[model samples]
Structures are given as C-alpha cells and as structure tokens.
Target chain A: MKAALGVMALAAALVLIGKAERPETGWSFRLPPGFPRPRVPADNPMSSAKVELGRRLFYDVRLSGNGTQSCASCHVQSRAFTDGLANAVGSTGEIHRRSSMSLTNIGYASHLTWANPLVDGLEAQALAPMFGDAPTELGLESAAQLEARLAGDKTLQGLAQEAFGAGGLTLDRVLKALAAFERTLISGRSPYDRYVGGEVSALSPEAQRGLELFFSERTECFHCHGGFNFTDAFGHEGAEPERKFHNNGLYDLGAGAYPKRDQGLIEHSGRPEDMGRFKAPTLRNIDVTAPYMHDGSLATLDAVIRHYEAGGRGGEANPRRDRFIRGFILTDEERSDLIAFLESLTDPEFLADPRFGAP
Target chain B: MRSLLLSLALTALPACRQDTSAASLSTHRLRFIATLDGAAANCKSLAAPPFRLRDARLFVSELRVIGPDGETPAAFVPDSRFQSVEVALLDFEDATEGCEGDSAEHTELVFEAPVSSVRAVTFTVGIPFALNHQNPALARAPLTAGAMHWGWRGGYKFVRIEAQRDGVEGRIHLGSTGCEGALHAITSCAHPNRGTVHLELDPATQQVALDLGAFFGSDKGGDKTDCMGEPADPSCHAGYRAIGAAGKEAARQSDSLAANTTNPAMGASAFTVIRRTP
Candidate 1:
C-alpha cells in the first residue's frame, strides 16, 4: 500500500511538471509596447485549444445555414480580412445592411456590430451572424438543427469539446470559441508598427509625410481614429476604457434622417439628433477593406479620403451636415501620400502568416 | 485528524448562519402593475392621420424602490427594499394585438423583494442617471432586453407607451433626447422627459395603478401625433411634449401618493389595493 501511494504521488508530480513544461504551440500575441490587449470576458477565457477551434470554425463553410459560406468567405485573409464587396451577401442571398468590416485588430472594438450599441462583446456579436433572423447567416436559431449540423462532423465535436469542456455542444460555447479564435487574429507587425517602435527605415519619405498628416491636428484624422490602434474608441486588457461613436455626416437625405434603409443609431434611440451616427472602424488595414462606411457606398481608399476631404456626402447640397465636416480640399500629392500611409498600416507578416490561412 | 475536521466545521458554521440571517433580513417580494384604463383608440395604421392607440405595448425599465424612512438614497437596488427606489422597463404585453375599442386591462409586473426593513419606496419613471451613463455593455437584465436597449443611443428608454388614438395607431416612445453622435455624452445629453416618482409601501396600500388616460388626455391639441414614426413631424413633436408633461404630472402624483394616505393623488385614488393573506 505504501509503494502504491508513492507511485501515485510520483505520477501526480510528473503530470504537474509536464503541464509546466508544455511548449506554447499556438500563436504568440504581444500588444505594442505602449498598447494593451483588449478586454476579454471572464466566461470565455482565452486558451490555445479554443483559439484553434475558432480558427477552424472561421474557415469552415459548414458554419453557414446552406453550407455555402464561412466567415472567410466575406473576410478573406489576403484582403486583410475584408471582402472587397460593396456590401456583403449572406449565405441566403440577402445583401447586408453594411459592408464587411476588416477583422484586423477587431478584438479591441468596443461596439461589435456597426451602429449597434447592444452588442459589445465578440461572444454577443457572434449571435448576430448565427441567429439574426432579418439577415440570417448561419441560421442556428433552432438548437436541435444546430446540434444535428454539428453532430455530423466528429472533428468539430472533438474541437468543441476541447475548447468548451463537456458542455461544448451549445450555441453559446460555439460562439465563445469563435470569438476566442478571432481575438488571436492580431496584426501589430506592420511597417507602421515598426516605425512607431523607433525603426527609422520602416517608412519611406512620402509615407512618413502621410503619417504626419494623419496625426496632424490640421487633417483631424486622429480626432476620430486615434491611439496605437488608430481608433478612438477601443477597449482591451489593461487599457483605458473608451467606446465613442460619431456622426461624420454620412448623409442627411432629408427631414433629419440619413437614408430609408439605414438610419444608423437614430432608429434605435428614436432621437432626431442621433441621425447619421456610426462607429468609427479601425484603420489598421484600410487599404484592404474597401467599400467603407456602414452602407459601403465608397469603393476605394482614394474615394474615402475624397469623401472626408469634401467634408461628407452632400457637403455642398445638404445644409444640416455635421458642423465638424467643413469640407477641406487636399492637394493631389497629399492624396497619394495619404494612400501610401494607409498602405503602410498593412502587416505583410499577418497576410503571409500561415497560422491565419487554411492548412 | 478528527479534531481538525471538527474545528473546521465549527468555524464554517458561523458563516453559514450569518448568510441565512442576512438573507432573511433582505428578501421581500414586491409587485408593480401598470393599469390601462381607457377606451382603445381606433386607428388605421401607424403612419395614417388620426393615429390612435388601437394596440399598444409598454416597455418599462430601471425599476427601483425608495423607502419612506429615507435610509437609502435614490440608489438602484436589484430588489425594492427601502426609502430609495428606481425601476425601468424590461418587457411589456403587446397592446397592438388586442381588438380596437376594447376596454384596456392592467398588466402586472411581479418580482420578489425584501422591503420589510424599509419605510417607503420611490422609483424613476425612466432609467437611473448612473445606469443611463454606463455603457450599454454594463446594463444587464430588465434594461438589456426589450426595446429599451436602443443600440448606440447611449441610454435606455424611460417610457415606451404605444397606443392607437382616434383612428391612428402610433407609439409614444420616450428616451433621453439631444443625442449628438453614436456615443452618448453623459454630460451633454439631456432627458427633458425623464422624471421620478415615489410609492409608499404601506401594508394598507400594497398595489399601485398607473393610468394611460391622463397621458393621452394631457395633450389636447396634439391628438393626431405619432412619436414612433416620422419623428421630425410637427404633430409627433407636439405629442412628445404632451407625453413629457403627462409623465411629469404622473410622477408628481405618484410622489404625493406615498406621503398622504387619506388624500390620494389624481391617479392614486383610482388604484384598488388588496392585502395578501399572511
């Protein structure tokens, strides 16, 4: 009996030592020196198992209702996680209200969906694409159907269990896993990051000038999109909490409304003054995520800068435009330089990283 | 070994006993009922003229209870317990489903509370100032669900009263006004329509009734207004003003109902309270 007890103790110690010595197999993420990791929920703790499961799910077409589209369908990694569509088309052939936003550094986003205040966390935002009836993507409203769909694949079941203990069959667990995977999709190794990190040769002369213009108070680009992440409203681990929204005067069709289909935050609040307000997206890979804004009306980065330079859509036509959007004209050289600066934000390492791509 | 186990058990006993005592002292049940007492207004559609309350749904949140003894300042408690109270909408019965011209009925909001230790209870007609100032991410329960959780508006709706009035069915939704951008600036934003009301938790008068008639009747000229649709319309603006006035009056009456037993307030007198069998 004494010998058996000794053996048991030895095995337990070995297990502990093995756990301690376990090499980190997953991606190694580190926020910029001055930056911080975005706030993550306690319920969905980050782990390598969960992140791997999320990555697989993100690329899997079976996640959609018709098994035709995956998160990757709209968010291609080559394009910096944004499909260059004017507006994303869901699996059901329904056009989305807005363009597909770039997933680069999305973990720091305060508000998940465009113009939606209710959805704050990535776990909660997963519900919009999975179960939202109006623009159904995954169509996992019925638990039974979701269970049946997931049950067909042994690999998915194993991944789900590995990520979410024994009770990993639920929709909430799936979403939590997906969110965990998305949070790992960090891209901070861009040329801009290198420049910020004191590397002199990181940016060319023209790109440096564009960067100066971006941070300059004259252009006022930093007012909306500030901080290391280039977004004013960002929340992350150990970072000061900030969740701001703005009305850059997207449009004032008439009668204190933006447009018929997309009224932004005004429809939710039922306030007249809240018209044309939308959350400012991260400009980490602005060159890739084309068709900007909530409606995806703008097609290219040049067009987007022109829109801002003109002060907003209908700047000369509409009188009720936001006061901040006093149309300013930029020189032709300045426009090219701004585009170059935006291109500098692209992390070549992220786009070429095998971890983000399919096996 | 036995002695050590016994000592640990004995030491843990006090904590369990203290928990029971604390729970016993702070668990009281309270019920909030909004009674609709008026003939339903016949309306064709939500946008049509003479938009009346054919069918209406009311969503209220930020529920709180204020004790008459005044021990607790107007803080937001999960359950109604003492001199301070504030509660907002969580959910409501859809009024649009009912037949037009039917006599409206009362909807009961029943929840468990520990209010025996408190003197009086007061509640905000809308969400509390603190909760309103918080990010929508922080708001859980009652406030998170229903129409009150308007995305990006920065605050919950104080009152969502939908009614079909005079052949025009429309909603009268009231939230914090003066929203500039997507992010609600707590200091800059204004909720002119928001007000507070108090309820005296007397064993004699346990039940309270909130009437919808006064809200509709208060705005005499803005009869054809609809605050739900076409928010920029003059009629809608006038209707909002009328509703805002009525909410203030109702709050004043509710506050008075807590203090005076014999002389009930305008809407308080109509309420019938029944004691639960002990």
Candidate 2:
C-alpha cells in the first residue's frame, strides 16, 4: 500500500507538469520579424476555427445574394488576391468605382477600402460588399434572409457554429471570421525576403542594383513605400500606426474633378483638399497586380514608371498635382533596372503553393 | 496561506487608490443655443415667415469648453477634438417629408471637464487644426461624415448654408482658399482667403445669435444671384465678379455670416444643457 501511494504521488506530479507543458489552445499568431499586425476590433478575437471557416466562406459563392460571386471573384489567389480587371464588377453587374487592390498582407493595412477612411478593419470592410445600398454586392439587407440562407446548408451551419460559438451565425460573426482568415493570409517568404533575411545569393546583380536605387534617398520611392512590406502605411500585430493615404499625382483632371470614375478619397471625405488622394498599395507582387493606381489606367509597368518619371498625366502644366510628383528624369537603363527589381518581388512559390489554392 | 492573502491584499490596494482618484475628477454640464438670421430662420418652415431661411443647417466645429468661472486657455486632448457639428435644416420621415420645415435646430456636445476650475466656453467655427491637417481617409466621426466634405477640394467647409430665393437657391460654401493641389510641395499653402469666427460661450446665457443676411448682399437689388452650382456656371462666376472683384469677397462674406449674427436666434429657447448626473 505504501509503495502504491508513493507511485500515485509521482504520477500526479508528472501529469501536472505535462498539463503545464501543453501549448495553449485556439489560434496563436506570430508575425514575421519587422512586420507589424494591423489593429483588430475588440469584439472579434482571432481563432483558428473562425479563420478556417472564414477561408471557406471567402471562397464560397453562396455568400452572394445570387450565389454568383465570392470575395475570391475580385481577389484571385494566383494574382496576389487582386483580379486583373481595371475595375471590379459587382455581383449585380454594376461596375465598381475604383480598381481592386491586392489583398496580399492586407492584414497590415491601416485602411481597408479605397476611399472610406472609416473602414479601418476587415470586419468593417466586409459589410460594404455585403449590404451597402449603393452598388450592392451581397444583398443581405434582412437578418432573417441571412439566417435562412446559412441554415439551408447543414455543413455551413455547423462550420458557422464552430467558428462563431454561442454567438451563432451573425453578420458580425461572419465579418469576424472573414477578418481572422485574412489575418492568417500573411505572405513574406519571397526571394526579396530571403535576401533581406541575410542570404547573399537571393538577389541577382540587376535586382540588387534596383534595390539600391529603390532605397536611395534620391529616388525617394522608399519614402512612402518602405519597411518590410514595401508600403509605409502598414499596421500589423505590433506595429506603430502610420498614414494610410497619399496624393501620388495620378490625376489633375482640372477644375476640381478627379477623373469622374475614380474620385479616390475625395468621394468619401467630400473634402476638396482630399481630392485625388488614394491609398498606396503594397508592392508585394507588383508584376502580377498590374494596371496601377485607384483607376487602373496605367496598363503596363513601363507606363507606370514613365508616369512617375514625367510627374503625372495631363503634363507638367497640371496646377493641382502633388508636390512629390515633380517629374523626375530616369535613364532608360535605370528604369529597366527598377522594373527588374520590382519583378524580383514576385514569389513563384507563393503562386504555386497549394495550401492557398481552392480546395 | 497568510502570505498569499497578504500578497493579494497588497496587489489590490493600488487599484482601489486609482479608483478613488478617478472618481474625484469634476464634471460640468454645458448648454447653449445657436440663433440664425436672414433666410436661415425662414428656411426651417415650408410656410413663408419673415426672417426665415430656405435651408437651416448649422455647420459648427472645434467645440472648446471654457471653465465656468472665466475663459481659460486649455489644450484640446488629441482624438478628443471635433471637426464639424451638423444640425439638420429639415426633419423628414424615412421616405416622406415632414410638415415642419427647416427651423433653428439645437445640437448638444458633452465632454469630461478637463480642469476643475471651470470658467466660460469657446470653440472655432471650423474643424480643429490637428484633424484638419490629417488625411481625409483617416478622419472619423463628426469630420468625414458631414456635408462639409466637398469631395477632393482638399479642405473642410467651415460653414455650408443653403437658401432659395426668387426660385433660385443660394449657397455659402466656405473653406480654405488658395488651395493649389497636393503636388505644390510647399508646406504652407496660401492663407485662407477668409478668416475664422471665434465663439465665446456663456453656459448661463444658453443663447448665441448668428446673423444670416451677412452672407450675401441685399437680395432686393444689384442683380440678386446664386452661388449654388457655381462650379459649373460661368454666369455665376460672372455674377460673383459683379458682386466683388475676386473670390476673396465671397469668402469674406461667408466668414462674416459664420461669425456675427443677431437676427435669427429662433432655436435659443430650445437649448438643452448637457450635464452628467451625480
């Protein structure tokens, strides 16, 4: 009996230690070094179940009213989550006012939508495409309709409950799950990242020279698009807040109009001074997400370079152009080098990675 | 066991002390009413009344409360600053128009009294300097979601008053002038063509009057014109030229209308004091 009691005591102690050693449950996020996590809403905490559910929802066409479009319709995973279209078309066949932005590393974005400054998080952004009256995408105006739709599918209902727990399948819960999934879609394993992480042979000679020019103060490309993400307006798991908008002299269409279709931040703020200001997109896969700017007017990378080289469109005569857009003269070889460097940002492995592909 | 209890007790002592200190901070109630003039008062009512306005919205921003005792220079806490305070000119049902037209409407703003030694209150007629300098995409609440945002013009309209006369609606849109796009590269654009109005608030009085006629010249004679849709109308620009030589005159008139007015104090009686109950 004495021996058995001693053994039981030892067993209990070992069990306690094992319990302590067990990793915490739910989702745990560890942002890459030098990367910061964007601010998450207090209501929605990140969880693995919710993220998995949101991933499925993001790819599911059933979220749309007519079951025709999903978040992936405008944001293809192959092209760094940005569709090749100049302007995205809604599920209802209405043309969007602005170009579709790449969702790569969008978890670190300070502002979510193109023009709306109020949409600071993914949860808020999901609402616009879901219920916004002006050019509606998913016509989820009634809660009953959403509930019935979710209840129609047994698998989706189970997934929603597991993801949202006692909160049930609500609009807010859907938004939270979608946001969680987006937060997990972190992409930082490019060759450039490897080069920055101390690998000497990661970059070609031309790419290295291009990187130098990019970082150089003379070119000043790094001023707005700097740091690990190549965009200064980055917020992540632990980064300090940064500005989300800049006037890159994309348009000076004269007489206080910013190219009728693409009003940029002006449409949202309605401030005259805010006219023509747009969020600077991340250059993670610039080679894939072509037709740059809020309007997607520039088709080729060379055209974008030339536009920056000559200040802006409508010539040096535009009175309303931003000060930073002073037309800089770039040599032909230098321009090509910059293009090569930009191409190096593409992660071929990321494109072919099956983990992110449609299941 | 005794030591564990002591440790818990000691850890909780600081929190109790902090709670007591936070409870001691004084809070005050603020109340005031804005009076309008000219078409402002008339616009509130569909039926024509003397000294009435056609559109009765009041654009107020940068609310600063002076202590109850006297005017004290206080630093507005960051993120606590307000941009534009809007009092709608008309009240309408979800889809249909209400019987009552635009009248002098009352607005309420409340904030924790920063300092105990309260005096009077003051506020600017336009957005605060800090928020005004920020990118419009980042501005939230009372700043971006207002009629004052004149999409891409680059500045907040300090005052936006609209009125209709002789089958033509007149508007007074005021903001920073001499704005030369974002690419000018200069730190300071030219000074606003117009000046700002400084409002001194007396909580006891609970009434403030703003004259509306000051925004325009005599509507009876000298070519009564409209500034509404002036961006597209060459004739409107021509009319402005006849009114004054440059846009500076219009801006100045807007400033005067925003600042000094005594005629249309219609909503002063309805002013409600915002006070925190003990």
Question: Interface RMSD of every candidate?
Answer: 8.6, 11.1
For model 1, residues A239-285, the per-residue Cα lDDT tens digits are 54565667786776764457756877666555666677778888888
Report the C-alpha lDDT of model 1 over B58-134, residue by residue, as the tens digit: 33333334333223322233432111233423323333443221233324443222233544554334554445544
Q: State in Å the error of residue A183, model 1.
A: 0.6
- Please give the DockQ score of every candidate, comma-separated: 0.05, 0.03
Best by lDDT: 1
Q: A259-313 in candidate 2: lDDT tens per residue?
A: 7546666544446777777777789888999878777789988998888787777
Cα TM-score per model: 0.56, 0.55
